[model samples]
Target chain A: MHKDRLVAVAFTLWAVLVTGAFLQANGAYLFGKLLERLGR
Target chain B: MLAFAVTAALILALAGLGRPLAWRLGTCRNGQHLTEAELWALAPLLGALPLAVLVQVVGAWRYDPLSMAVTLAVALLPALAFLRLRPFVPVLPWWPWGWMLAVLVGLMAVSALAPPLDHDSIRYHLTLPRRDLELGRIGLWFGWSIYEFFPPLTALLTRLAYALGGAAAAQMLNVFWVVMAALWAGLLARRLGLGPQGAMAAALLFVSQRVVLNLGAAVTTDIPLAAFIGAFAAVAVAGTEGARRALLLGLLLGAAMATKYQGIVAAVAMMTPLAVLALLRRRGLPALILAGSVALLVLSPILLRNFWITGNPVFPTAHPLFGADNLDIFAPFTQAMAARSVVPGGLAALPWTMFILQDAFDGLQFGFPILLLGLPFAFFRHQGGRALCLVGIVIYTLVWWGAMPHLLRFLQPIFVPLAALAAAGLVEVAVVGRRIGWFRPVFAASVGVAIGIQALFAGSSALYRLPVALGLADIRSALEVPAFQYYGLITPCLWLQDNLRPGERYVAVINDPSVYCPQAPTLHPLGAGEAARFYSRGGLPALSAAQVAEMLRGGNVRYVLVANNPGTDDETYAFAKHRFDAVLLPILRQQKPLVDSASGKIYDALAVLAALESGIGAAEPASGR
Candidate 1:
């Protein structure tokens, strides 16, 4: 309920959003390449 | 392995040469010596500019291996006097060291195993230097591309690397720049009064960025430019008010300018505030003047060369001021770039779009979201140099947004200062959050997750090239692998190198990767646009087969290398389809190519032209009807 806690919560949410977006964008391609290489 | 050894030797030599100079300049105004970390970080940064200038001087005379060796020996001989200065031993915690080791190994593997094959490197970075080595002098090859007029500092440095240990060596040399940039980031964080952990975090954040990982090992100017810009920021933020500091700042700025044109923007961003502050205080004016003059001295070679060749000190830019006609060849490509106007969602949306839709800018996903997330938290701490770092980032980004192309890589230099701020913010937030229950754990977990994802991406990218790096497979074999086709026109270029006789000239069309072709290929800058504009004159469609053949003969071009698929949506294909297909393709189709594959076709230009001339003569009487 404190302002500092609220700030921390907001930052945490932003970090999660960013991390999710990055993974969503690049995770599939990276994993696919790894799989392809492993198969090879 | 030889390439790696040569690159390492070069880096140590540079560090040795720079140590005393950095020591002199980095000592605080109050007579305090630099920390070991700061000195080691500053040494290579100080050393590289002078060596780059030395290479330019030697290159201007002649860029032979013997001359380069002699120049290097002369430079190293003086540095030997500073042997008493001990070797740098980084005193970092285990985790940071682990991350650094991983990144370094991955980067070195990629750089040491591969020849320079990235698009920009092949196009000009390595190609220009290769041409200089061939010609035995660093004269302007105006016929190649407009990029020839750009600052040749990094190219000159690459030339030394190329002369010593070949293309792989030059690539390995670029990895040094990446390391230097990361080191400067850490040093900047330290100057901002961050603890050792925060400094290491800043360095790791910078090195782990996808953009850095992607281009870190490539023989390109961006990484080196970033290093110089970062070094300048670190020095500027030290609050050392003396002539030596000013000189150091000037040299770094000059080196950055010589590395890339965007350095001009960086210089303006850094100096504008300092100049204004100094003017208000009525002190430091003389120091500023000394710094400005020294920077100009460092940059004068490129400016003079451009002025001599194009009548524009900064050619390709300020064309309107000079009214120079040399850039006419670049008009179509330049116009196409202008039409793209790459800033999507306008200036207001740049912050959102730059991070979210990074692909829209240049197809390279650059910068981490953690950087954006951590940026605001730096303001909460009210740290010593936070205000300065924030101002530099803001000014640099604003200028880049307005004046420069919206490519993510151009904004790379700003990442050094931004990473410092971000690291400071994260560290500060964690320190503050310890008072609140549950905040520290949640924050730590989120930060860890973000960094872990980035590391995974970086590691995966590096892992793909590990086989060639570990010598399990030959580099040639790796080049032929379909999965590694983005290594540019290696197969076709090697085929040309093997086939083309000495003294025979080839013309590379559509995609020019002539750095790989040793037989002196004439490059049509970005496909057939410049070729259509120059050789065909009015248009390829307007010119007859005889005229085209005559033009080819006039240029003494014997072979034609054409990429069949140059990506239709890009400007290369658009220009080729509009102008090249009209006249050149039909003539080229008449001849059986010397080499043909999925990559492209290589034709005997003389044969193609000969057939065209004879066919035109044969059809003249029939056309009389």
Candidate 2:
């Protein structure tokens, strides 16, 4: 159980990091509409 | 050639971009080198995706903004990841990915050489793609038009194929899904308590069969539907907390739902397991959150689309809880048609023996008879497994009851779990073989024979082709490759681009316009039985038989290709015969034949366009003038 939780935490952190990077780089293209609205 | 070149470049570029990310993911998961088995398991799945560059590139010919974006994401991400992962792993298994790839590529080649055999796809799937290529935009869809409402995921791939691979790009797309399905099956097997080898065996068994042959190599929705549903199920199982996984599950579920209405059932079915876990497990709040969030998230986009178009979130099926009727008297009444309905005599009307035999135990032309073998054992073994199997059976029973005289496509979701259960049974057999020394040889021989029988059946059906053996000899023939041809949604669209003329308008009278014209000149989907919208005001619905005849008289409709063949009343055939002669005779006579096969026929571009534009009345004068 402890190992599984640790694995889950690691997976989550990795998912967030990768997703964040993708959002930052390609964010302009992928989420342009939402971002523009947010800026407003 | 031009389209194929461009598509290849785009795929390579996107793959390049994704490699870093894919590598990052792999590194994060296990780090450094991969085991022989992991390499083997991973190889086939990755190689199977990002399939023929021609298919994806061909879609650019039409350039649907929405579909293009999604394709770029799916294609590039995986391609890049594979490239990155390969370099990181030093030693890999010879038998794992290597053999799997050999068989898969072989199947693809063989199926390509075989004739297109999807009954409905040829009737309309290829028909639409052919039209899309010929026509720049699709106008309207009607008459056996249920196909139009399907999600754009597969069509986008087909459009890419049409852009890159010319007409046969759908074949490449099929190879892609065959890989996706295999990967998902492997994942599902792991979840069901199978080793890597066992999972591979199950994946190969499911992918390299006759039933898979029909959908995997052709442009059909069944395999994609199955893939999405199974993926959703896997995700649902993976989620530890109810809330966390539920949210993810919802998104996946929604994506599946958007793919097809049948996915709604699959989404619900998948949720049932999570719900059970929530009830049984201590972390009920998290489970509930996960399940509910996922369901809502996944269902929202389609629900919103439905609500926006049909004035009800469910659309075309049921009225919204707080909404008024979305129809008026003038529109065609489409309310009573059910997605699943009961016909009198049901299975009795079908060839009961053949149906039972095929459903219970499919051989070469189909999958192994897992349901019969697994259900009995499931009852005696794991309670949870038995419960899951029962739920699946109930769902299938309801679906079958409602969808009497249904096609094989309708049974996909049920099959996913059935395959898992069957894999469990096979694992048991392997264990039993290990226990008894003498039985080991017999078991191995039996497995060999079973595989041989399946291969022979699959080969005889011309569903797919097997690869050349690694060793050249009569005995080594067992190592033949497996080729696939089904492209899920892309098949019809690819056919359209290859056969049809560029810059023509082919009106598809269906909600899912991709069914007829993947890249039509003027695509006007009738969302949520919005038939009246087309009929009202300046919509294409005004282009009725009389209107079409008038357009033909004006030399507007040069060619008319209707895919509502064989299945419908003789009225449609009679309608085409009378109208084409009375209205489009001159144009038909003058126009070049676009496509003529067992599927349908296409005609000259100018004639059909002219007929559509000028109305049927100006047949001689409009052209001459």
Candidate 3:
């Protein structure tokens, strides 16, 4: 992979880890509420 | 409506008062003035200094409306004379403005218009100010709360707002600090040689954060401390030279320290690098000294007051060093907080834990990820202010981790520098995107989505409370809802306000939420360290029913408020059950409570005492009702 592409891939993985962790820990409840409200 | 209006007026007044001082200090040695963004950012903070000082001075005399109005008039006369109006212009792009407006409106609807419901706000932030106003002086509320010994700057400011309008206005004042912090973050970004776009990104990122949105518009020291810390960073990083810069830096440092104890950690973190850098240059030594001196001068009032009362410059912290008595009464509470550290893997696991297990650390999650994502990128490029911000963040995080990493809220100051560095990182990512076509859209989409998620959360939270803010629903009725019923003392306080006669006092036991009962005089017997002095002996449970009754009678307490359910599993309850409940429960059974709800039960002190004397209901078990 090109250096820039490698950097991009690593950054994408880090973002996923962070976002996933957030959702699992705290954001899931709020997000669930948001989704439920939208469903209603 | 009146609260919003009063808050707006106070913001303008503070800006007016601070403008002259900010201008004088904002001028660079080369004769160029700081950008308007920088000047305006510094204005409210600079303006708040004199007002805070005035509050302390007037507090010695009395905190009545007459005294407050007279002092304010005297101070504002000069401020009004120096006030200069400038045409309002929007410097940032429309997108940043839209996000800021949405956040601001949401905060106003959710927090500013509603009665204070946050634990710390009711416990001390608004409570202490209300207590001082009621007492007609700012004397030592020694047994009332340990927070009385904390820095009084924000409390002083809150008192001013509370005096002017009410608790709602005091709550609304925090909105000003939020905006000021955002603006200061933008100023710091600009100082870092990040272009206007980067500045907007920094500011928007800051305001849209979960922590900022959650704590915004509540009467808390966190936002004000962040604002002052941001202002300090912005000024410290400016290319200004000599005494003027020193003076401005000192004032800001002092303000930060005066806002909260964590301010001391922030100052040490940021200033250590600046001092070392200055020493390396040799010529900057005198300027550093001048700044240090000014900071001490600004912090002296709080120091002197604490030393005078408790023989400790920073009371409740360094108790053994200063021989500050009675603080040991709170050791169990403090120890419980220490034991509650949820960062499982310690220092090595901090970064992951801070970002991932935020609930364990007792904070909302969105802010840390962007910081984690962007800060590393900030170091890749040779940005002007990047080195300073990076060092500050590193030192601050390390110190915070060592001291109290469990409390994510204490890390509020680091957000100022972290936001700047993260914005730089985002800018760097954009630079990379220029070479790769697909990367550009991805970058935009990511940033947009992150900010959108934050705004959505903030807007929804605000929507829940929109009826109260819009005056469509009564605040009391709203507070009675199950969500707020646990900590919201409004319902019980309303009952007390109606029932308690003049010259009557209520003793609150294991209930710290009596702050809402400003109309009635209330005392925290267990909270005030009196339990340690009178009830406990030989580290064993020695409390008796007669002793508790006598303490109440001696204090002229007519009512007794006991926590039936403290909402959370509190150490105080655990400790009290062993030592206090056995004695008090028997007495409480004798009297029909004046008010009983989920929050607590309030009993007639006279009836309880009569029952105690008559030996009625003596066989009631130690188990609490």
Candidate that would win on lDDT: 3
TM-score per candidate: 0.88, 0.61, 0.89
The C-alpha stretches of model 1 lying farther than 4 A from their native spots are: A1-7, A20-40, B28-33, B96-101, B104-106, B279-283, B324-345, B471-487, B519-544, B547-558, B566-583, B622-625
Candidates by lDDT, descending order: 3, 1, 2
Better of 2 and 3 by DockQ: 3
| Residue-level lDDT tens digits of model 1 in B207-299 | 777777777767778788888878787777775367788878888898889888888888878777777778988988788878888889888
lDDT by residue for model 3 over B249-268, one digit each (tens)?
Answer: 89998899898888888988
Q: Which stretches of candidate 2 lie over 4 Å from their true place?
A: A1-40, B1-101, B109-117, B126-144, B242-244, B310-355, B359-371, B378-397, B403-405, B437-449, B461-530, B533-549, B559-625
Model 3: per-residue Cα lDDT at residue B227: 89
Task: For candidate 2, write residues B208-297 as lDDT tens digits.
Answer: 555775566566656666666665554444443433344444545655665556777766665665566667765555645655665566
Clashes of 2: 96
Error of 3 at B312 (Å): 1.5
lDDT of 1: 0.71
**RMSD per model, one decimal:** 4.1, 15.5, 4.2
Query: Which CAPRI quality tier does the interface of model 1 achieve?
Result: medium
Worst 10 residues of 3 chain B by lDDT: B569-578
Cα-based RMSD of candidate 1: 4.1
